[model samples]
Target: MPLLRARPALLYAAVSLACPEGALADEREEVRTVLFGSLDAGRSTFVSAGAKVAPGGIGRDGFVTLATLGYGLRPERDWWGDPRGKAGLTPPRTLRHTVQAGAVAGWQWVRDWGVAALFAGPEIAFEVLDSPGTRKLPTPRIGARVQGELWARPTETTLLTTTLIAGTARWSAWGRVSWGIRVPEWSAAYLGPEAALYADRTGYRKWSLGLHATDFAIARLSFRVSAGWVYEEQIRRPGAYGTLTAWLPL
Candidate 1:
């Protein structure tokens, strides 16, 4: 799943959005994420960790635009792409492998009730489509990506978050929106429903609906989780999917 990979910042958004102005909900000001799920073709996993820092120091007003520098590992295997031609003139469902590494930097406009941000970066993807019996195909090696986010709290105990990402690599894109209510007894956690959509140049598209949770902290680490069902346009059926995200201070 090629996303804005904004989860790097999205994790930060989780903390910043819910915090009081000029204050941080958690003292840990870093992003360490592990997003993993099941794909019918195979399995999917993405892990990234980076810290947020304001140059020099933060202002008394608390308005800040933080930069992120870190590492990301995105591996796609047994993943299928659509045919390259029309009229049945191209190969179909070509399985491929892709490797990507990139950096993301964004500015955050933080408020007591919400946060808005935009991020952009370059991604290099090394791809090869090699199936046991199919012809080897050539693919591009690099791409650029951009993403935007809006996280808001409509009520003292509710959350509404949305993020969108697109990239030139594999012509992939992703978007999701989730709504949750705060649970004071559970470390002020938020729980609710979420919907996500994604697509690729291979003409693969999917829609997913599931449950999401936020702010489950244990000691120095915090956690986020999403689980649900996905309907694939390519396969014309439904499959199970789950994702877990963790964050630690740099």
Candidate 2:
């Protein structure tokens, strides 16, 4: 299967929308903010911050809507030499940076047995490549993204989720099966297996074990962590990868 390549912050936001009954919800309407970061084994890193606002009267009978805005940065290194060669003076690595800003309107509906949500919006980004020998100016690009999520609860303690995110530039899809576990003083804990596919030049696939926690604090907050290996068909060696995200409601 292919792995989805969505930004971790956006993925967390989609998960929050899918599981509205979890720690992301409050009795009253308010704005929720989130800060997230992820580092991959390939030396790629991303950081993002976003906020969602839910107005009163938008949610009724298991249906809700929210307005969201976010900004993200991706910084990665590109080396000029082959790693398989003997140790010698290696060429300097280039630093490539991508900055993005976007907004989306999301709608979610929940029933006794399942939940569904979708969000779509436009984004603009700038990319800058700083090579060892040359400096490049920021190049601008415009794109749009559409993301959908579904959650099904077969039993009181088991939940299944599938998410797909597609955009003008890239696409990714993932699925997870979680079993709710008992944790002292915590509102919820889920242990699960997750798999993902990304439509990229290298066709990356990810398999990992994941844990999701909600309401662990007195205030509204959630945490997710995943560790696993990533394989690319074109690459000879697979890489180990891990991601941790903390979301706080303010």
Candidate 3:
């Protein structure tokens, strides 16, 4: 389970943290693929895959304007039954299967240790409810969504990232911020604290605080991993959460 697994699907409209290390530093045309998954208190899970297309090897004066064509597939589930199973009580859990699809023209500006980006697009979502708790099904829908991101290295060893999404589609309506202090010997990696807030029409609202390590590199992949405490207004009690996000360039 992820201490920060509460990465709701709405955030995947998503992938707001663009580490400079994976943004095609080579100058040739490239696609930056992202794979991420998150889980909380041994219950909910979110998995998403998306990509950004941009030119490699950019900027000489530490500043450049770029556009990336981006799209993603997000599939997720939230189990609303049984709390840590006790005794012989095995109850069928209420679950939600949600799939989201969307595309965006991503605009970005990278300058020195700071990056700002914007993306907007049309999104559609299909949801299936296996909730033995509530025997109701909602209609499918679509909407235009916009997302904004800001990442900065305020000092040589500390980093800040903030993301906001608004509009339609199950979530594009959340915001998250993370702060990182660079590790002693790893230049591209940081360990820090993260906070997030999410809300929706379905009455699903929650908040979390966790510890995270961002932009850890293993060969061709850059990874972000988190784990922490979460409190959901809809859930009976606070739960454990965590998430893993990886980026690959090609």
Candidate 2 Cα errors over 4 Å, as ranges = 1-42, 57-95, 132-135, 169-187, 200-219, 232-236
* Model 3, span 1-250: residue lDDT tens: 1111111111122354334243323422233333433333334565666565443322221212222222222222233434434445444535566666667656666555666668777777777766544556777688877878777767766777898877587754778999887675664567899998877666776788999887666786666788898776656578888777765544
Cα-lDDT of candidate 3: 0.57
How much is the lDDT of residue 243 in candidate 2? 54
Task: Evaluate all candidate structures by whole-model CA lDDT and list the values in order.
Answer: 0.55, 0.45, 0.57
CA deviation > 4 Å runs, candidate 3: 1-42, 55-93, 132-139
Candidate with the greatest lDDT versus the true structure = 3
**lDDT, candidate 2, 44-100, per-residue tens:** 444555554443322222233333333323222234323422345444444546565
Query: How far off is residue 202 in model 3, in Å?
Result: 0.4
C-alpha TM-scores of all predictions: 0.69, 0.64, 0.72
Sorting all predicted structures by TM-score, with the top scorer first, yields 3, 1, 2
Query: Which residue pairs in model 2 clash with each other?
Result: 2-197, 3-196, 3-197, 3-198, 4-172, 4-173, 4-197, 4-198
User: Model 1, clash count?
Assistant: 0
- Give the lowest summed-lDDT range of ten residues in model 3: 1-10
Number of the candidate with higher TM-score, 1 or 3: 3
